[model samples]
Each structure stands twice: as C-alpha cells, then as structure tokens.
Target chain A: MAGVRILVGTAKGGFILRGDERREHFTVEGPLFGGWEVFHLAASPVDPERLYASQAGGWFGQIVQRSDDGGRSWNPVDNAFVYDGEVGDHLFYDGTPQPWTFQKVWHLAPSLTDADVVYAGVEDAALFRSDDAGASWGELTGLRQHPSGTQWQPGAGGLCLHTIVQDPTDPGRLTVAISAAGVFVTEDGGASFDPANRGLQSGEIPSEQAEVGHCVHKLAQHPSRPQTLFMQKHWDVMRSDDGGGQWTEISGDLPTDFGFAIDVHAHEPETVYVVPILSDSEHYPPDGALRVYRSRTGGGEWEPLTRGLPQEHCYVNVLRDAMAVDTMDECGVYVGTTGGTVFASRDGGDNWEAVVDHLPRILSVEVQTLP
Target chain B: MIRVTLPAHLRTLARTGREVVVEAAGDPPTIRTVLDALEGAYPVLRGTIRDHTTRQRRAFVRFYACGEDLSQLPPDTPLPDEVVTGREPFAVVGAMAGG
Candidate 1:
C-alpha cells in the first residue's frame, strides 16, 4: 500500500494529491486555506504525518499552519518572526540603504531527522528555525549579518531567502540561496556563514563574478551526491562540484537558460530537469511549446521530454519551487505551472500527464513517498 | 462588555460570527484596550489586525465607530459614548483593495 503525496502550494490556497505507487491516478484534496496565498508546503522526512505550510497574504500578513495528520487537518501555529537583534539595512532597489523588514515566509525546510524541527526561509532575507514544531521561531541572524550583507540588493521578487538545502550527511552544514544576493553556506550550523558564489557570473551585475550579487533562482541537490549541486540561475543553468564552492555553466544547448525551477532525478544523481523559458522578459516556453528538458549525463547533454505536454499556444511559467521528484522506483517527476496545471511524468521524463488542471497559480510543489 | 464587529476574513480566522463581545479593561474602552482584549481572547488574530512587534494597525485595516473613521486617531483615544455603552459596535474593516 505504498503511496505518494504531492503537497502543492498555490497563490490562493494549498492542495494535496494522493496517488498510489503506480502514479497513474491521483485524488485531489483541498483549497486548505482559501483566499490566502500559500507560499510553500513541506512534510518532515522523519515523520510523514507532520507537515508545515507558509500561509500569507497582504491583508492577513503571515501565519504558519501545521498538520499532524498529514494534511487531513491543520491548526495555526506561531506567526511571530522577530529578528534576533538590531535589524540592519541592505541596499534597496534604488541603491539606497533600507532597513531589513519582515515580510513573509518563502520556503520551509523540515529537519531530515527531527519531526519537530523546521527551518523557514523568509523575505527581507533571513533564516528562522523552529524547534518546537511550528509553535515558535527564532532568526538565525548570521546569514543576514554576513560581511557582504550591506551590498545585497533586491531582485524583481524582492530580497528573499527562497531556497534552503540541508545536507543529510552533515546536519551542521546548510546552504541557502537568496534572490539578488547569490548563495551562502553555513558550517557551524547557523552561527556563521560565507558566500559560496565563486564562478557564478551574472552579466546583469557590474562584476560578472562578484562574490554575492548574482540573482540565483533555485537550487537542487541529490541526497546521495550532496557535494554536487544543480542550480537554475536568473539566466543560466549551473553545476557545482565541491559543495557550491565553485560553479560552471551547464546551460549547453538549452533554447533559453532563463528558468525558475530545477530538480535532480530521484535515483540518478547526474540526471537533472529544467523548464527553459524564453527569457527574463518573456516568462514562457519557447515557440509556444512547453517542454521539460532532461539531462541524463548531468548538465551539457539534454533532450526535450514533450510526449504529453503542450506543444503550442502555451504561455505558462514554472516557478522556482514548483518542481519536485518523488522517491519511487520508477522515479516520478512533477511540475506545477503558473497556468494552473500539474504535470507528472511516471517513467522519468519520457511521458507526462496532468494530475489536476485549473488550480490556482502554483507557488511550490513537494512530494512525500509513504511506505 | 464592548461589542466589536470584525471583517469577514477576520471573523472566519477567529472562528466567530460577525460580532463578538469582549471585556475591555479600562472604564472607557479605547481602541487599544479593545484590541488587546480581542487578541487576548483569540490569539490567532494577533498579527492579523496589527503588527506582532510594533502593534501598529496594518496599512489596509481600518476602524470606525458611529460612522466616524477612527483609523487615524491615537490608540489611546477614548471611544465614542455609543461604543463605550455597547449601543454601537466598534467596526474593524478591511479597506477595499486589490482586484
């Protein structure tokens, strides 16, 4: 009775899709918190039943929702995300110094080992950890207080710490990516951090290889090969061999390298997937065709998997956190688009089918494999 | 008990009806005291109407009593006699915004 649960965060609410191991059929569950923008939804690897969601909107602000029964039921947890000490300032859009402010949580990373522990990546660029499930939170200020923090600028999406990758082998080591600020790595847990964007060149910035000004869109890492990382930058697809210490372009033959979502195959460490959009200005697929490019030999070699996808008149964009892979034997890959379609590829990326269509614009997609 | 009318969204969040009654601490219940009591009764509504740290009313949130806009008034300003006597319910409204 093994199953897979796909937790989808959308602009309006959250939905959970349940499918058996075959991955052919799925039952859709909710609009959990209607009228609220659900930024991200994640379940603890340690306890599949425990889940956390980042529910936020302009009118109601931010509220963390927790589900102990695996999205069957949920309750509101602590929403207070106060900074640790004096909130410093970062460069505003106009290059003027602006004070850091708490906006909303962008991503949630549950502990790899502890069900009660979770980390929240939030806008205004800061990290917060909650040890008592989602009942409380405390900022891990070292990332924001880095020496190069003053030079950090907001991307089009605002200054947000959107992606967080935790090393399964080393709990103390964590890597986080910020928009318009590049990447940061922490070795001593959250006590300290260092910029890890060496070889990441952004032509948009004054210095192409600057230490911490690149706008990284998303990052993906395989559990077995933690040292090797795949990234979808604002304009390029990249790979890092030494745990993000150095990176090299792998955008190779992509029609366009500007995309938001990137993910690695569940069983193949070298296999990665990315949806190439036209460009930064035109946030849609090339030639009105939606294709998910898969690279079996890591970055350089890739092929389009478009069996069941839209080949014409498609103009939807895939967000940074809208792609995920489930740990099934066949390796199921899922992608949610801004046009409200959730596509699933049961046999790697060769074939695809829409699990559910016409949902609100999807914000994030996460999968859980149940035993 | 001071009667307060909440916006649709806030009422749904607090799991209450359109109107709720709370006991404000001071003899003359001001906006601050009434909100403190409301938050104390329903902790989930803490940061919805105002900020968690600064306690400032959210930009789009407004307050009114006896058809007078009280959003610009100081937090400590006394409520009108109708509101204080429970004859009129102090209103917490979400201003018209977004398409």
Candidate 2:
C-alpha cells in the first residue's frame, strides 16, 4: 500500500507524520533534535528514504542533518557555510553597507535527479551546493556576486534566500527567491543569475516595480507545467506564465492578499491555493476566521475552503514554507500553522481535519508520496 | 590527558556525557590546543564552539577553568596547572541568554 510521509520543521525541533494512502490517521514521530529551531526538512524526490534537515538556534549555530532511512535516524553533516573569494557588502535596512556574514540555513532543496546532491539557501542571502550529500558545501557565488548585490536590503526577517525552485524539465535552469531582493533565475546551473521580477510590484520601495526589491514570500510550480508559476508575495497573489519572465496580479476577489504561503495542487496544473491574512501589519486570518482560498482556474477566481477548518477565533498565521501537497491519487493538501497544528485535506480541499496539534510553532511542511 | 566539561547541548551533539577527556598536543596545554583536541575527537563539534573560518569563540559560548572566566583570554594562552594536569576540568558554558 502506498503512503505519505510528512516532514515538519518547527521552532523547537522536527517531526515526522506518517499516514497510509487513505490519509485519514497519522502517527507522529518526534521532536528530533529537540530544543533547536528546525527551519526546514526536505526529502529527496529521487529517493524517498533520503532526507535533510536544517537545524539551528541562538545558543548554537547551524547544523545540517541527513537521514538515509527516512527520518528514523540522523547524523550531523557539514555546517560550515563559508563565502567564496572576497565577501563584499550588501545594503542594510538603513541603506548602509554591511559585509556579508554566514547565518543559519533557511531552506534546503535536494536534487531532483541525484540523491547525493542538494542545494541550501541560507541567510545573509547566499546559495550553497553539496555534491556528496551534505558532507560539505560550497557557495554558488554567482548569485550573490550579481551587479545588484549591494542594493539589496533586508526584509523584516533579515536578509535571507529562503526559496530554491529547480526546473524539473531543464537541468540547467533554477529559480531562487530572496526576502527583499526579488527573484533570480539561473540558466547555467548556479553559475550566473538574472533577475526575473519584471511584473512584480511593491509599494514600499521607491520604485514600485524595481528590478530587485520586491519581497516575494513564496513561489509554487507544478512539475507538468514548469513554466507557469504562482506566487504569494508580501501583499498580492500573482501568476507568471513564462517561467517568471513576467507576472500579472491574480488577486481578484480575494479579501486581502497579504499572505506568506501559496501552493499548487499536485496533479492539477491550473489549480492553486493561498491562505489570505489580514494585512502586512497584521499576520492573522481576517475576522479571526481561518480560511484557505482555492482557485480552480489558475487565478482571478477563487473559492474559500472553510469546511472542517477553524472559522472563528482562529488567529494563526501560515508561513511561506508551511503549505504542501502530496501527489497521491486524490491529492492531499497539508497546511501547518504558527499555532502548531497540521491540517490536512485528503479530498483536494473539499474537507479538512487536524492531523496533529500542539507540537511547536511550525516553520515548514513537506510531504513525500511513497510507492 | 585534559578533562573537558561540555554544555548539555554540546554533549548531546557530540553524543557523550558531561565530561570527556582529550590529549592536548601543545607544550603547555592552552585553550587552542584543548579545543583542537576536542574537535579532533568529535568532528561534529568543529563549528559549534567557534567560528569555522575565523576560529573565534562564539559570542554566547564561554570557557572557564579553576573558577576563572577564560573566555576573554586569548586562545593561545597557557592553561592553569590544575587544568593542564586534570586536577580541575575545563568547562564550556553557554551564556545565560534569555529566550
């Protein structure tokens, strides 16, 4: 029987939730690496048993752990994230130059082809690649060394490169999103990058549609249609048809588009999902009612999926990496909240149920479908 | 042999108990030699106690020996006789940081 394994990263540690194909009941595994902030946990698409975790805290710095037998056991890998030659300055929030420094790893994107290869997105905003699994890492300096590097400023969460989207069809193409620096695409596999924020707009910056200043919260793409992308920016819900060459606002009929999470249905190319929060200043659901808006026709028309979800007195926020979809026959959608609840919809957002609750503040949720 | 007491987290990470022993290679055992031996014994603790590139002790990680704060001392400074001879254990402490 096929099953789904959900890897959840939380403020206190990491947890694994296992559910059979029916997707009804689940057993929670752990606070693996307890007392640490697990920013993200990712499993390799090529090998369901291979997994990587980004664990860090204030008292102790970053530690990358890799597991070969799924999440049963883990061993610490290399945590050294040294910048390549000549670390330069980037703009701080006050518009002053600050030297690039190494911080915790915010996101890890294992290779879609090779189980031994993985890429890490880290704060202080840089990309790193490990060929021998997670044993060692080297910075893909071209992205940071771009001409617009110095002008990029930190968002409220500090300057971090939190997203790395690999082009499923084209091995050489990859897309990465930073907090306040907008999106950048690499055609030569991390050797060089180009800004792809053509249609993105941000009212906070002096130029609303600058080349590289938009705060892109999260981006989602379906494997079948890699060129089409859906984004939940700091304020607007957006879609791009040309692999991020240009974007258009698809925030029509939504209450408030100020959200952090956006994801695509596993098997549907046009189906998309976004959780709408109140506003930029307020991070909770509108009217304390938790709702997930789904768009069957890509965007511009959306319907709220409220069945089995908390409709009132629910003030939790969904983070950018907290929503994921499993590629099962029925397509399971999972959402983890700041209130430490993992909500699941087994029947494609028609109905939902709490898979697990009261663990820790969830940071990221990723699911792997095992055959 | 030099005895070292690691913080609870470090002990957990190194997969050991509170105290571990290492053989310092310096002529007169110093903080640098002791740390080098510790990291050599447990590779996982390389970047945890100090910066990987700069080798500077982490901001919140302090060192103590013989009831004296040795965190501010230079890494190359020789250790006290009691610490070098294993009469007293060198301690690695995580500073009291508020959540």
Candidate 3:
C-alpha cells in the first residue's frame, strides 16, 4: 500500500480518500463520530496508525474521537480533555462551579517531536495540552486561566482557538489563533503566552469593549521560516513577518475579504491557497463563483485559480479545515464546501477537478500518502 | 401554530414543492412540535429532520426564526406567539456549498 491517504471531514462524518500515485479514489467509510459533524481531522505526526477527529456539534454534542487502525474503526477518548475537578488537579481559571459547555474542538496538532504531546484549541478560548497522546489532557494554565478569558466575548462560533501552529524546530514555540481573540504565542512550552497582534486589526468594538486580540479567521505558517505567518482575518488576508509583531494586508486584489481557510505549500512555504467568500452576511460567495486564490510569493500577490469550477450562482462556504495542500510532487490542493462538493487541484491550483459532491457540508480535509 | 419553512430538498422528499405548513399546540412553538406536525402530516419526514432517538436536528439543517438559533432552543420552548399566529415564518435554511 502506498503511504498516501486523504481524509475528508464533513457534517456527516469523515471520508477517507484512498488511491495510488497514478489515480486516486474516494470511499465514504464514515459517519465515524456517530451523527456529529467532524470539523477537525489530524494524523499522528509520530505514528501513522493513529488518527484524531474533532466533531462539531450536531446530535451528539461536540466531541473528539480516536482511531488506532486507519479510519476503519474509532473510539471516543472518554477523558480526551475533561476540565472538571474529577480529572486530576486540573481546573478552569474562573473557578465557576458549572461544567464547561463541552465546546467544539476546532483544531488539533500532534506534537512535532513528542509523540504523546498533543495540543487542542477549543471553543470558549480554552487551550489544552496532552502528554499522553490525547488519552488525557491538562489545561494551559496561562491561556485558560488568563484574567481576560472570562471577559472575552464569544464570536459567532464562540471565543475559540481555531488554529494551532507549532514550531517544528522548537517544541517550546507555538502560536494559536482565536476568533475575535486575536493571536497568542508561547516561547516556553505553554507556561505563558503573549498577545501577538501588534499590527493586526481586531475589528471595532465600543471603546469599552476594545482590548487585546483580533478577530482572526485562519492562519498558516511557513515550514522553513517559522517567524513568517499568513492569516485570513475577519475582513482581510494579512501576513506577519516578525511573528505577528506586525501585519500587512495581502488581500487587496481578491474578490472579497471574507474567507475561512488558508493553506501553505508543504515544500514551498511561499505558496499558499485560500477560498474567498462573501463576508458573513449570508456567509456565501459573491455571485456564487467557486474560486480559490493562490499566492506564490507568500501573499505578495494572489491570482484566482478557477479552472474546472462551477461558473453559475454557487453560494457555498468552505470552513478553515476544509482546504489543504498535500506534499505530492504536483502537490494536491483540496477544498470542501458547504454545498457538499470536494474539489482537488493536481497541478498546485493551476488546474482543478471535481472529486466528489452532494455528500454533506464538508468540515475538514486532510491528505496523506498511504503506505 | 408557529410557521416553519423547509428547504427545497426536504420539501421534494415530502412530495411538496417548497415550504410546508405545520401546526403546533403551544403558544411559542418549538422545533420538535413543528417537526412533529410536519411528520404527522407527512410520515416520510419522520426520520429525516432529526433522529428518532436523539431528536436532534440533522447537521445539514439550520433553524432560524425571529433572530434566534432554534437549533439549540429547547424542543419544548414556546416559539414566539407571532410565529404561532402565522404573522412570521421561521426559516429552516439549507447550508450551501462549492469551491
């Protein structure tokens, strides 16, 4: 078996895309997390056998599930990351006696060097770290217990860390993006984190409501230059060179400022992809054009990649996890939309082809080379 | 008496065009009662809107009316009297997709 595989997380469950170097095919072996919407799907950086999925709310509430054997079977990690007093000495900062809302797990990252050290960013502005490969987790005391956490108003999705970017070179270095909460980074594991939204814009609130944190939609990191980061903000696509210390708007020439997902090439950090949508009115694209923008010089300039896409009125929203870039030679760039359509670009967004459609609202898209 | 609108797909499945009329016994109608009335009139919609066990709305369906996310509103909650009076229509939007 080739070490290439693709996992598409949708409102229904997750579908594994299996195929060879010459031709790839998709099989819907899912509804993996019961009837919940799986928004985040991640593969174990240390072990290919392990897979993790964070399901968005539906019938089963928000939940996370683990699979030890590809996508064939799955079991919920009962103690995935409970914050109640019953689980060890861990506790929330507010000390509120009420239980957590069981918020959605928006993003998951298997540790870069430590096999068992997994990180999860969840709704309600919570951050958790697991030293046991997600079997159990502890809240990041600094971010979770920050004085500001309680007052942080929840975005439409809630005050959540939707993206987690870890420095592959330095295990201690990490960055997290929270919707409406801006961006935060840690240099020493997670003992502490500082607001990194120096030049980033955090939309306008009444002066009384304004503070740190920006309304960050999505973010991507350069594999070679960790300090260089790309982000899709609430109303703009911007980039930070000094590690979020400052930002520059790169979305000047796009169709619209509103978009959910952003991806960087595995080999070419400068190359990135984004699915543009109309700002959050009805949360669909303007004029229903199904197009994605590609940037080759780290958002220096972007061009619309619209080969093989629907030209008529198409009002589909693509979630952040729904678009990704694989490491194949031609580099497979895939994006799933709320219309239940999954499109793939084999020539690195230069050309496109429809892989599947009419399945379910897609939540996340992950690609791996199967062995 | 609250008014609930169904997307074109479910309406097609129910053999209706678009938007089916449903009746509720309470003041402020809820997702459950409206869905119950819809299912009662069209048995074909029984297991489609929500599961029999959980009664939770399917992932693809969104419940909106009077600026509220009826999805989380308790199934038994009173849907606003306006909706019950047929003066206002609660929209059940179908999430769109592409790209």
The candidate scoring highest on DockQ is: 1
TM-score of 1: 0.99
- Model 3 ranges off by over 4 Å: A56-62, A84-100, A206-211, B1-99
In candidate 1, how many Å is residue B6 off? 1.7
**Tens digits of per-residue lDDT for model 2, A209-295:** 799989999999999998998999998999999999999999999999999999999989899999999998899999998999999
lDDT of 3 by residue, A81-178 (tens): 44533322212333333333445677888877766678888866678888876667777867665555554555577667888898878888889888
Each model's TM-score for chain A is: 0.99, 0.99, 0.90
Better of 1 and 2 by DockQ: 1
Across B56-96, the per-residue lDDT of candidate 1 in tens digits comes to: 99998999999999999999998899998899999999999
Task: For each of the candidates, give the backbone clash count.
Answer: 0, 0, 19
The DockQ-based CAPRI class assigned to model 1 is medium
The estimated TM-scores of all candidates read 0.99, 0.99, 0.73
DockQ of each: 0.78, 0.74, 0.05
DockQ of candidate model 2? 0.74
Worst 10 residues of 1 chain A by lDDT: A18-27
For model 2, the superposed segments whose C-alpha errors exceed 4 Å read none
C-alpha lDDT score of every prediction, in listed order: 0.94, 0.94, 0.72
